[model samples]
Target: MKNRSFALSTALVCALTLAGCGVLPGGSQKTTVDVWLMQGSVSGEFLERFTSEYEKEHPSVELEVTFQQWTGIGKKVMAALESDDAPEVIEVGNTQVARYAESDALRDLTLESVRDLGSEEWLPGLAEPGSINGSQYGIPWYAANRVVIYNKDLFAAAGITEPPKDRAEWLEISEKLDGNGRQGIYLSGQDWYTLAGFVWDEGGELAVERGGNWEGALHTEAALRGMAFYQELQSHGDGPKDADEVTPPQAEVFAKGDVGQIIAVPSAVPAIEKANPALKGKLGFFPVPGKTLEAPGAVFIGGSDLIVPEKADHRAAAVEVVTALASERWQTELALTMNYVPNKTTLAGVIEGNEGTAAMAAGAARGRATPNSPQWAAVEADNPIKPYMTAVLQGQDPARAARAASERITAALRP
Candidate 1:
């Protein structure tokens, strides 16, 4: 009887050991979700902390995030999708989101999923680009718009009392501040985003839909007028002449107070403040002035977005990640950390904390999106507006340049 009892006890112990080693009927491990993000604007430390906190709350799920360069992320995502190994969640640029959505590469985020999410609780303009054919393909993470960043010290020295409020005044002010080893305005003539403002302000459409098809409108009379004004600024030495001399590659010029005013995005604000702390209180911001139009013009929506690929294995998990990122708390945190506009409506207070961000956000609220057609690449490539803009700035005829650019754009848009 003693031997039988000992053997029975040993058998029970063995069974318990096997169960601990996964021989049990209903024991499994937690699932993990993969997320991909761009590196520059988002901080790694913050992401790590956020991920850790999320995992603590969700014991069954683990999140793995990878960072990539801003320029090639789209291509990388496309390749990953082809291999059936795409990240469950991806952060993409606002401009690129349209192309992906148009290709049907993203999952359709129903209105129901986003309705109570309060994703639209932030600035309304930031949410505009994510809507394609009345469906949401991506959620805006953050956004930046154009603002006239001026050196107050320079403006005062030039005997200017206030920032210009209209196009005529802006041009007059530029002339007043020009010459004497200092430019009235410092702009990069080759920047498409910067140049695009003039076109939009002049009532030009970069691309327009007609007869159930998208067509290039970069060569319209409005565009010509816009391009002519841009050239005039460069010719008067109000800005830089070429792409290489633009703000990013050679910001030292602006830092040294060589340029009086510049149409700057919000991302450049931190750098300008950091580089010249003494000029902090002296810096000023306002909307980009219009040409013939009485009101301020539209500016490009510049920033990142969150997208889920159609080929992702964990579609539900990906949606959850996107929802979390698009949450009011997360969007506000991102705006405060990244200095860009938030997509959720409730986060406006965070951005409105500063006058500059507030003013820029207001301007962006009224801005228009870039063309959403897939052939945008071809249109941009064949467009001669950039070169013609250079010629116009160098004293070429506005009409001639406009005619030439219009012809090129028209040809490029032909199916």
Candidate 2:
């Protein structure tokens, strides 16, 4: 909190210094729009370019940008919202919009989304979580999600000509590629995020809200079926039953070159290639298969969203800046420079030539976030889903494990 406060204070001092010198010849003060963006989301060069271009275009406005770390950001944001000098714009995780909006600290941006931003064109994974009840609070920024990264040589060896379009095909293809001292898919038993996609494909939820209260829904029939599919898929590989993907770094394991596939975000490609240079051109990707061919499997989208504080002194100016950042031009620049999926589906073409990001963009169209509860963070902090998955994979009764896990989830989700 101290570091965040210091960063804000420093930004304010710089903003005041610039404002002092920014008075127009007509004696009007330049409007300073203070913004807080996560430190690693964008590069220093990008920030500098944006600031230079924005300030030049609007001579009467000055931009004050502050970079904040993700650690303990919740408390820092809450404090800023409660203060008299909250930032005009803040960037939050796509899933965290609900928690801040719960305090009535964020401005409702539904009208802006419809009237100016083309809400219909935004990615649902980023849009759905930013919206609460019927109003939009967070503006979609960028997103990334899991995809099936497979070895091209393995597929060819297995006599597979193309990627699977549905779960049955995915399984059959994986099985075909599984023998001769190789794993078909290196799917860790406790990768609950991947399991969530399977659950969603079965029309089950991690949790459900009833009368404004959330309860874990993993014990339900639909969810159990999802879990069962996960078990069947895990049998294709020899991933550890008790640990999650990062226990020994799944990328390192996949880099050993015997694994046919792994469900991971596209960003993992660089690390995989770096670990085993032989895989540089051998890796290919596709969206995780769904139950039906109508669409790809549902994925847990992870990304950032831009929000305006309710107490900002320059609301209109803040909206203008946010609009610029989320616009097609900036979105293109951001995606290409940062290797990210743009906030809108229509912008997927910008990365069409990049195979990994292109696949990620396709999968992001069917993306979904975790249950929208501020307390959802608490649930993640002490997640029962991981252990629940391990138990099922280790031959424990899924119903019993799910019941206990759900009970814990239910308690954690409660305010």
Candidate 3:
């Protein structure tokens, strides 16, 4: 039988307040409202500045922020929710929000509240997954879509002019930019997020819904075609093969000023500048080209969402923070300061006029989210498809690997 004790006790939590309840870490401040965020997801300064800003603006209400590592965060959250001391607000990956949403562990956001929060401009692709059935469980904090960061100097030295205009040209440019001590590009081995773009470009989706259910679509002819092209790019590029290219990611190597191209998030810009200042004016960014020669191809949007846990003591303060964080000011500044796409498409105007940020904004305009399934976490958890995907990248048959991987994904998605 389901445990009814927690539910029974929560009924006594009417108009709950953080006053005289939870204490901040390292100090005994009773009114402090604790917030939890994923480490390395947002700039520490921006995160801290908001906390400072909120505390100063509303000095009576304290905001105590904490960050957690990406590893095992879901488990940590689940464990935290079972206790009475869970943080009031949590920022979790958009993909992981459904797990808690479906479990009734998150606060249900209403349309009225969504409007009041100025989230009407929120990215639908992202906001949808955070909503279950018909209610919103989490609000998109910010987002990052893959944009092609290239070494302009390399392109010029290789006699290549502008960024590739199409899929074929993209490959050709990479080939021309190769051999003189630098890789045309580095494709990280076993990185499904990057490869998934080609899947959408080839008219394939990671998964499709039919008859009120979802299923993997990797083995479809169109998807296989895309997967084949993904392998082709690796074989043609002059970089570490799938095995040697997995760790450190292509972004790290790209920052060293040797690799010609890499598909990465806007945050990589700061890293590249920090690593080699010489590459500052030399680096350029564009959305990954697609089969149709579109400037911004279908990119996988990556980022987290802000959620109020069901166990929050200071619901009013937590909801206020949620609304404040989801405010247009916070959301827009988030993208501008951190180089991520904001939660809304309307904010694309903010990042416009700059080549690099503009390209990312364009990519976000055409971005896609991961498949929304409660079991998707499990699928990503025990991804049996990675080995076969690596096999394909390392010269194994693409078709065979796609078929096998698709079958595995299908089985994994099933009840």
Candidate 1 per-residue lDDT, tens place, 315-381, comes to: 8878877887777777777777766677754555787777777667766665656666555656666
Residue 179 lDDT (model 2): 81
- lDDT for each residue of candidate 3 in 1-415, tens digit (9 for 90 to 100): 1112112122122225322344333444535577887777668778767777887787657666666888888888888877888889898888887788767878887763556866566776578778777788878888877778888888898888888878889888888877767888777666677778888878897777778577778878888887787777775455554443447656567877778888777667778888888888788888888787545567788778888888888876888888888787887778777777778888888877677777877777777777877778767867755676787767787777777887777777775
Q: Pick the candidate with the highest lDDT.
A: 2
Q: Give per-residue lDDT, candidate 3, residue 373.
A: 76
Residue lDDT tens for model 2, 164-209: 9999999998888888999999999889999998999899999999
Better of 2 and 3 by lDDT: 2
Report every candidate's CA lDDT.
0.69, 0.90, 0.75
Candidate 2 has a TM-score of 0.93
Q: What is the lDDT of residue 145 in candidate 2?
A: 92
Question: Could you tell me which 10 consecutive residues in candidate 2 have the lowest summed lDDT?
Answer: 1-10
RMSD of each: 8.8, 2.9, 6.6
Worst 10 residues of 3 by lDDT: 1-10
Q: Which pairs of residues clash in candidate 2, taking residues 3 or more apart in a chain or in different chains?
A: none
